[model samples]
Target: MNVGQPKHLSRFPAKTDLTHQEFWRGLPTLQAEAVLLGPGRLEYKMLQVTGRDLLIFRSKVAPKMASTIVPHPDWVVLMVPVDWHGDYVFNGQVARPFDVFVSGGPDGYSTTGEKRHNLALGVRKSSLKEACANLSGRYIEDVALDDQQIALGAAVGTRFHRRILETIAASLEKSLGSGKFALDAVVENDLFSEIANLIMAETIEQNSVSSINLDPVRVVRRAEELFEDRTTNPPSIADLCKAANVGTTKLHLCFNEVYGVSPIAYLQAKRITQARCTYLSAEKVPPSVKDAALSFGFTHSGRFAKRYRYFFGEYPSETLNKR
Candidate 1:
């Protein structure tokens, strides 16, 4: 478990800023929300990262009313509990406060509690993998060893690991300040180095573990190609699984392990990218955002709007009007 002074990220009131929904529709970014519940409901604080990989938010919650927050389809989250007790589920894994857990999805992780103190960080998948790749050789059949066991030591090795986690956490806090633009790259590098080092060292020590044997690399490559193809309908997950000749669970893990996001998230990201470009190109048409979302396969406009707000900040109308 990692611990430090809690830091508050800058919050943009999502409910008040209607145009913020449009901003998310136009970019690839990491976004986060910190909610402090009151009487019935109060405005949640939103932080949208335009050109960054890491985000951190600390919230003060009440002890009786639970909060359910859903993130966008482009984030993999890490939650550290500073206070309270609750069930934290990511994908299918359930975790307590002291245990560290990782999961990939476009939709992000979820937590419910009346009152809790927590630190939430969301990093982009591509950035995450690139960061992890810095420790290329230590990977056992492409699966990094860091995710295999809980790292808790007090030696030179443990101290070093602690330092790395601290650096990453500190860099995240820096993102909430004026030097954010510059600190983005720094944080990514530090995070990657730390993860790679830990994984590589553990891999060397744990040589007894079996190696991974799968075709996720191929599956991911084909999936990316399908995502890029806009002419006809691309292959579904099953089709791609067949095309790659891998099991569904293996394929899911591979894509997530390599890309830091699941297959579905990758597809949705592609659709959103296309929709943004289309929306930006047709300022003269004045089409509804719903129509624009539909053009790219986002059938649930309200959900799309919420995701848009998370990724960008303004609603689609604001994006159109700004053009």
Candidate 2:
């Protein structure tokens, strides 16, 4: 019976372009961290809207990078790619334009890409479950209640993908926050029902890699934890292997399989990324780049600057001067 237009939407201004920091700060995620993988400055654009029970974002980013995003604890996030100029990986799976990547877990998801355009929706788990239960047309049995994260995909011209586009349009538009009307319960139910029906729809079109063993993922995660916790002395391959409880050969294989990089290089990339943060936030130039480098375990100035440029697309001095 509810008929009012949406008034629950938060008033986040639409953005045409943003710096890497601005873009990361704006994502509705918890403890989100991003690292640059390609050289040069990054370009990003984001249009965002939020509701009490949901958040929607239309965004694009360039120059290729990786991000570890931990979304709201009570919500299930769905990422739909509208344009993918290069490989886009989400949760270690290649995200195609046809599939809607979905996840809701404590561990969150890892995303990396270049020249990617996407629509992301974060819907409250309780609200979504209620909507699925109350859907009038679809039988209750169609919607699986399993807790595992999954990507739902269908062939082109299918109703599911079309409805996703429609959802993105409605969720990202300002109309939801305009005027006297409110997005009442009835309208919300209808919207969620549309999503629910599509998600539970049979015969999804999917041709992705088969399930991975997941042991490699665990090894990488353990190694990251050890590296992050270490100070003054970086762990050697032996230490990393001991921490990960795997042999050196197995550790290398796992790291490469998971991140497409060897352990040492990948960990080094992470270490320097912390230094970039200090530069990004510095009010005035820090006393010296070498101080920052040496503190983060970079002893050789030439090697530090070269690696910094590769990861952030700028020299340490240049990044220090940006702000």
The candidate scoring highest on TM-score is 2
Compared with the true structure, the alpha-carbon lDDT of candidate 1 equals 0.46
Q: What digit string (tens of lDDT, one per residue) describes model 1 on residues 191-271?
A: 444443443454433222223665567767865665555323433443444444443455567789888988667656666
| Cα lDDT tens digits for candidate 2, 211-298 | 3564889978887787667643455444465566654456667899999999767767776887787677646556478667655655
Task: Tell me how many residue pairs clash in candidate 1.
Answer: 15
Off by over 4 Å in 1: 1-51, 63-74, 85-94, 138-184, 195-323
Best by lDDT: 2
Sliding window of 10 residues with minimal summed lDDT for model 1: 9-18
Report the C-alpha displacement of residue 23, candidate 2, in angstroms.
3.5
- For residue 92, give model 2's deviation from the true position in Å: 1.2
